[model samples]
Target: MQTPPSRAPNADQIDLRQVFGTLRRYAPWLLLTPALAAGGAYLLSRQQPPVYEASASVIAVDNDAQNSLINNTLVTAPPLPQGAVEQVMHSRSVLNSVVGRLQKTDLDPALVRGIARDLTEELADNAFTRFKVRARLDPQQRGVYELRARAETPQAAQRLAEAGVESLIAWDNNRAKQGVIRSRQSLQEQLADLTARIAATPPSSLERQSLIAARGQVLQNLSQMAVLETAASGTLVLVAEPVAPRAPVSPRPLRNAALAGLLALFLSAAGALLSDSLRRRVNGPEDLLPLGLPLLGQLPLLRRKNLGQGFVAASHSGPLYESVGFLRINVQSLLQEGKHRRLVVSSAYPGEGKSSVTAALAESLGASGLRVLVVDADLRRPTQLKVWSPDRLATHPLPGTDPALPPATTVSEMFLRPEAAHATRVSPHVDLLPAGTPARGGLPGILNQATFRALLDRWAQGYDYVLIDSPPMLSLPDTLAVAPSTDGVLLVVEGAKTRLADVERTLENARVANVRVLGIVVNKLARVGSAYYSYGYGSEQASPPANPNLRATRV
Candidate 1:
């Protein structure tokens, strides 16, 4: 048989089947992780106390507006620089005033969110406080500031906002009065000096007259300064009064839970994909398609209840029966055109159920009315006898070959003395040659001898087909040694357990040994959906009679 060209590994290629298979395999974790995260977030959110917010808006008036409020002649303080309203609101002086006003209020302490012995100390030391300020420019190009405060109760939040507005207004008023107060003090001192000078000099003296006239002008200016001081008010004007909010602004449990769930879902999916990529296990038949080998059969994972009965007996009914029947048909079709009756069955690793698969295939082939012989080639670990029932062993032993030769009881003895070797019928049309005990350290040399091939050739004449149950290819060289004497090697791969790299390495080893690989048998595949393993007919349904038209025709 001409082997197909080997496929080069593509690093950038993505197999969607493998990706979906991995997700299906870990569906429970992917679903549970996000749900757990969302539930945790909601519970934590519920534990947090609600925070109520109230905001008050203050606008900065221009110098023109301030002058209109007071006398035009009065000197008003300079207009506040742009974007300085927030800084001034949060300034130590303004905040201290705010804290003092809050303390003098008759509000209950229990209503406040975080109250300390000293309100000033609490305001200064606490990194996260109830008070906050934001400044912005109004449409008129005037500076507007929004004073915001948060507390446990709506009434407390409103009180704090109102106190902030009152404090800022007081600070601005004091600032506006400073210039007028200083002017009045300077005028008063000049008037007092003029009176003292007039008393010391003669009434008719020119110097005294000049001083008297100057003192009258100072008196007039002082009177105007007095008026300005009483009329002057701060440039800051309260635009919007704070109101107690109906609802709290924070501790949104539903929104927080939703966000947390979405974040966790993304992370869990990424973790699953990364883990699957790193594991590199065979997920399905698509994983083996790159090897350029025909997939002869796929057996679903056996249920735990049916496992104790073993695969051979389990193959009599259920999905396993139909699957094994199909496998037997494929094997017969492949072997019909060529003289490939003798085949070695093995896997990449132990515990992959290669021995069970060999027994199952033998039983299936025998059911088709063909004589099948199962040879236990693994001398180190023989399992064919155990796989079959004890009563089935030596039920119909072959007659003695030559009267002069002693009959061989085991395969090891047959290699030593070929004339004595004989097969015992284990089932109808099925025989087993179990691997018997041999001297330690003597089996390897015995397998390598020419008599081993001669024994297989002689066995082929009596049986229609010989299935050699060999050891794992990667673990021991015994299978590789026995493979060359057979027609071809049948590789068994356990789905989701065997690594793809290990299977590739096994194929590479077979190539090096110059053994022809017939095909792959995917075993223990996970039963995912109804499409693959579940048949519409139940086990209790009557099986249709075998069709005579269905025959293993040669291609």
Candidate 2:
């Protein structure tokens, strides 16, 4: 029958309930990554160093000079005016001379050389890491050019700026002297040519006088030029001196710390997300697959030691018993359909808690005043009678000992024990059918064809639900022989522990045997305060921050 379609809720109209659902899904991830990033940023900010910067400037002037040695335009390039100051400030020639001066003056030669080399390297790196330097054109300032340097300490920064100024002056002085010598040599050559022209012939008085006066004027001009050169030579005026800086420019502690924290959080979040995505396995029933058919039941995880006792009635006060009762309720609810009044409990692999589920489920059903028959259909390992019977009959005599039975080692005789009571002695509401002693030959033909069918026919009307527990489908032919005769089969899945491929094969085997597969019962559902031996708190601990909106059934 078709149902009428309903109107969908608009996004803006969503209530707090829907918002909470979204939060629950992402809460675990939200808490993980940001924390990591913050920690990383904190460590980075704490480990950084503080820095200080100092600056000094110089001006290059080509003022009018009486002693113009070389044509100013020919000798000097357009003062990259800005670039030349910096080049002159830390020029190798200047630093080398300073190194030599420090040695001669008995100053710490090592210290001077070290400072020079260090400052040179520091300035070589771009401005962003060091100090910003600019050439401000100001006539009122000591020098029109500037040199700025930054270092680890205030003293170092100041010293660097001061040394750069001295070095630049020394370089300019040497350059000026070289210019003077070149000019002197050129003047001497021109004088010799004039002298030769005058001595080669009888020169008139006017011509001689004119030459002498011209020579004196030229000599006067040369002497004046020499005086100007001496005065103006090396001193680049100091416009501004080094003073304590107002703020330390380096190790922006707050900003650095913030950035470090952000980076740490980003990486941490990425890691957590990656791990969660890769690790999540379909572990629960609904998570495994949609419960399309009737959910025949689920069994709580059976502990290794619990295999010693079969009865897990609500009468037993321990948590083990409580969990068992819970399993019973779930099973009873699953059988509400009431199709064939009987169920075959089976697991894909051995030791998947099937036997315990069978016994507990039977106890649960029996408590409701409904007759529940528990049969041990596992021929290879008949555990029901051994677990349910105080006599320990299956272990002690092991069934095929009838003297009249005639050495029945095969499964048909061994699989049945006529001496056992139809009802369980320990559990009145539940009945047990032990796998009898080995009969003549083995299994497949004799046991499945005659012995099992007869037992089912005799017990058909005896109980409300005949819960036949069998061996794993892969373990033996016991389950196959019994599947066709049962109402439905309950496939048990161990969460996380059971692989998908194994479960698929188990389902395939049930289909091949023509069993009415009811549905799967996924066990070991995630729980709070539950611990396991193999998985530590890391693997087994339930991350409580799961979607608070969607919750699991408490029972």
Candidate 3:
């Protein structure tokens, strides 16, 4: 007996049965959305365009006089000259310039955003987040440097690769020349000043000496600048050119779409479970009421029943009529062989359709050809007489019920009225008893005597079946006092509104008085999934159902 969602702790741990049950319960539309989403994903996957990518390599070296190519120490060490080139290759300036060369148009914002996201993701994932520049391990190619990049289309892949290599080389050279140009031009101006000063003044004059000293200082600076420039220029070298890519690095259409679909599914699943906490929706039987008793029978909503030769009534055709009929038949059959000729039908409370059910039961039994006496024993208020009318009451019939049976009290003795009686004849084979005069001693006063016992015993003797209509058990002592006279009781419980505690109490009262409860009759039952009548339809139920067709068969 696993507790269902409404009482289960934490929606995340919903019972598997509950999840599936909810799905099945809401199968029409709730199940449709996920199916459509998955199908759409699969369809989109098939239509995806293909892409290819290719890669090219470039090598960089140290521009030092100590080595023509970048030495192992210089290349591997920090602050190497080619480190700047690596930086330039991965820079926004470099990547933007490369994209410009590709001439992309009609861009999708989503695709562009994803490309930018994945580019950073790939670079970081490949261990390139921090600025890293190192020389090759092989002695043969000691001066090489590597940079990685990706693009959506193959042509874009190729152009990006070529653009990165070209950008690195050009930026490196341009940076080197800017410093040399400034240094050499300044030196030339200084030398000219020196010459002018020497010519204008007497030889070895003060001005000329100062000009000459300045000129020497400018020339020394130029020499140092030139050395630095030359070293910087030689440091970078290309070992290979970028090739036209055979595949695209982006879009990963299959994987990305699958992830999107999976996320949708997971969120949908979690939401379906958690929605209950937010809404407090009822989702299962445990939420409505407890269940476990063997199902007696499910009665459908009846609109009408059979119209026979002065035998059937108008109430027989409706849903309640059919339900009650089937229920009465089931209850009568359940009695032990030759026992329970008398039965008390009542519910935990009023408005459970108990009044109408009593009428339907009488009609159903009489239609079955059983000589059933329908007794209205609710002396507080009578209903059976209205349904079964134009019949007169008679003296209590118990003491004369059967000579062989122990003598029971008579109605006259119970009510202390000589005129107290057992029943009335509503039809040729069926008898009816009104709740009788409500003024004839309040409910308990009528039930606390021989009249009640005599009515049950004599009715059982005169008819093949005896059905006593009583008030709500808890509402009055009517049902409790009358229940003991019958073989057993059928507690009619209305689903959804009826609580387990109330039902237990009803049985408890019957038990306290030593009444034998035959079985329970659950009414107002709907199909498990919905209000649809899916079960017991079209199939040949072994016995004829208490239906209008009355394809009669013994239960």
Candidate 4:
């Protein structure tokens, strides 16, 4: 499993399939997070108050009508440009005036001011709304402007637009009236001085005539100014009146939901990619691609609630049973080509489900009428014997049996004396050799002895299949030393817990011993999709409930 010396690093390749497979494995979270985010946005959007929009059109009018008429409408400088008018329409001063006018309605003034305050705050906080309320120049006509406004109600929106035009007109009228009043006062003062000068000049002098002519012109201009003030209304003329809208224009749920969904999707995809990058453990078959090992089978995870009851094949239904059957089938095919009958079960580390897989596989084979001998070779921490012979003698002797410290009582006694060691028959076709106790020389000394090899050979010739449950390959050297003597090694990998690098190291160790790894068995798989959810999707036998109590029926 070690990387080939000639091959480049794994980073050099872009494995999109593996990336997508990781995403698929975590699809529920990837889909749920985005859905929740979008749902929250939708709920928030729906809580917002509705908005009504209205527009009013206005045109710039010449305030100096009399001067224009006397001069035959000569070209004059324009009062304000379209850009300046747009700014004025949305200016705080103009909006304040509009708010004041709206507050003076026959309706409750407090309610009007409250809505106006909220709108003002919204416009101040949101740049979009600020620009939306501004005036726009008409494309078809020059010196024409469209003032738009938004409010909580149709009447308020219409009144706000109308108030913008009124404010402009009022401001222009005040400016014109002040200018006329100033001109009239100056003219009257000049007229009084000229008349006094004429009276003081006596007779008819050139200075008196010139003064009189200036005074008469001033008097005429004052009369024209007075008439101009009375004739013209204001500098701005209302071209279009604002009308109440039939429908509100805000709180657009559809648009808001779509935008929220897109945002959620972007964030969710980013999180998924980040998680995939940080993942270190193997989760499924795709994770085994780089290891170059054939996946023999996948056993569903036996939850803690389902454990402590022994081998998984006891119920003989569901995915665990089906997986054991498949493993046996693959082993049978390999054996048809003269493969070894002694299969050693080992894993990368302890608690990787190797012991459970060995017990279940042996049980499945035995049920098929094949004689199977399960040996607990893991001297460091043996488990097979405990599962098969729960009531087997550990320290006490069985009644009616040879009490002279029976020679073939346990596997440890058999290692010291193969001629006396006997296999305990658990079922009709299944037998077990428990690793009752370690010898004084320990596991290495025991497995390396000539007696242990001779006993294994003798059992290989007798039993149809010899399954040895060895200690974790990475944790101990017992499995590697005994693997060469066995037919093949079945590496067990726990899903989502076994690191790929650790499995690779374990396989490398096996390869160094020149042992053949039959295949890998991914154990403790979670039921996610249809492929793993159904126990017998295509089988003729109906699938039974999981964890059914065993009735000890004959196979």
lDDT of each: 0.76, 0.56, 0.55, 0.69
* Candidate 3 lDDT by residue in tens digits, 1-555: 111112324556755654664445444545455566666776676576655444455554444447744432222222234345555655666545544433353345454455555546545565442122344533433456764545556555455556556666666566556656676687778778777876787766787787777778877877766665564453355667656566554446566556756666666666665653354432333433443333333433223233231113434443444444556567666754674388887878876656556666676677678777676666665666555434243323432443343322322233444233444555545666555555555444666666658645644665777777778888887777777767767666664446566777777887798887765555544423322223443233322343342222111
Question: Per-residue CA lDDT of candidate 4, range 155-240, in tens?
Answer: 87787777767876676566556656677788889888888988898566888888888888988987887775565344467888
Q: TM-score of every model?
A: 0.61, 0.45, 0.41, 0.54
Q: Could you report the Cα RMSD, in angstroms, for every candidate shown?
A: 8.2, 12.7, 14.0, 9.6
Largest TM-score belongs to which candidate?
1
For candidate 2, give the lDDT.
Answer: 0.56
TM-score of 3: 0.41
Clashing residue pairs, backbone N/CA/C < 3 A, model 4:
none
For residue 555, give model 2's deviation from the true position in Å. Answer: 20
The CA lDDT at 121 in model 3 is 59
For model 1, what is the alpha-carbon lDDT of residue 540? 29
Model 2 per-residue lDDT tens digits across residues 43-137:
66557666778887666555435555644422331233435665555455765654555445433556556655664675566323333447665
Per-residue lDDT value at 465 in model 1: 85
Q: What local lDDT does model 2 show for residue 34?
A: 56
Please report, as a residue range, the 10-residue window in candidate 2 with the lowest summed lDDT.
546-555
Q: Rank the candidates by lDDT, best first.
A: 1, 4, 2, 3
Per-residue C-alpha lDDT of model 1 across residues 1-555, encoded as one tens digit per residue: 212212423659875666787788788998999899999999999999998999999887775644554447555556666656666665778777776777777678555324433345644675435667777876555778788988777887888889888988888888889988888898888888888988999989999889888988998998888888887777778999999999989899899999999999889989988987787887667677889888787777887778655556666667777666667877887788544388899999988888888888888888778889899888888888777754434533343345356667578877777667777666676788888763456675556667788767876775778999988999888888878887888889998778899999999999998988889888887653225346533252533332222221111
lDDT of 4: 0.69
Q: Backbone collision count in every prediction? A: 1, 22, 24, 0
